[model samples]
Target: MPRGNPSPKLAITIDPDVHENILAAAAREGMSVSAWMTAAAREALQRRAGLAAVAQWEKQHGRFTTEEMNEARRSVQAQLRTSRTVRRPA
Candidate 1:
């Protein structure tokens, strides 16, 4: 998808609990429910793709150097910390 382009419409059904949760989350984020769900779904798909790519790379390469592994760990930890900080209070 191109930057700044509008997203295409999608219709999906969720269980009642899930639907309520999505609405609550969207409200917390000050986003329309559709926008919030779209952003979340996009992030999830990207993360899955990233993990699959990393797995493929590891399978082909066998293993990484100690330094390389440490750098990856640090990068993941930084992302975790940032995500935690940005999360809304429950």
Candidate 2:
């Protein structure tokens, strides 16, 4: 017999409604539940890390002003629009 993949497996418990939602999301994405959950978990961790980094920066500097926050929001929205336009099929 061939050797199996060496990735570690996790056993998790979620509410029934959440479980059903996860199944539907995985099917919609054409991914196995494990793969979908792994992607979701990775995204969450990345977002958490980004927030922590921002907090550290603010500790050294100061809290962002309303105008600065608005500018950042606009910049992110513009980038998202550009990305969507680029992703569209011809």
Candidate 3:
């Protein structure tokens, strides 16, 4: 994929099975493998940032209680169910 500005490139090794899966996923999304990997990396970084923020909050405010965590899990599950039921254009 082309961007107006150039970005650094990365080279890494992975298991053959994982490499094949990445190829298939990239094709399914109509993206180049590099673009797919870049997107995946960005998502991972964002998730790490979110986790770090939560940990910092917990450190100041005390960790979440088990009940609070369970409630959050239930809310997320309900949202996932609702989202799956909604239809989108193919």
**RMSD (CA, Å), each prediction:** 5.3, 3.5, 3.5
Model 1 steric clash pairs: none
Per-residue error (Å), model 2, residue 89: 14
Candidate 2 lDDT at 71 equals 100
Q: Which runs of model 2 end up more than 4 angstroms from their true locations?
A: 1-5, 82-90
Candidate lDDT (C-alpha), each = 0.87, 0.89, 0.90
For 1-90, candidate 3 gives per-residue lDDT tens digits of: 887988888789999999999999888878889988988999899999989999999999999999999998999899989988995332
Winner on TM-score (1 vs 3): 3
Residue pair clashes in candidate 2: none
Best by lDDT: 3
Q: Lowest-lDDT window of 10 residues in candidate 3?
A: 81-90
**Mind sharing the TM-score for model 3?**
0.75
TM-score of each: 0.69, 0.81, 0.75
Worst 10 residues of 2 by lDDT: 81-90
Per-residue lDDT of model 1, residues 6-73, tens digit only: 76888787999999999998888888887788789899999999989989998998777899989989
Residue-level lDDT of model 2, residues 1-90, one tens digit each, is 448876688888899999999999888768889888988999899999999999999999999999999999999999988987774321
RMSD of 3: 3.5
| Candidate with maximal TM-score | 2
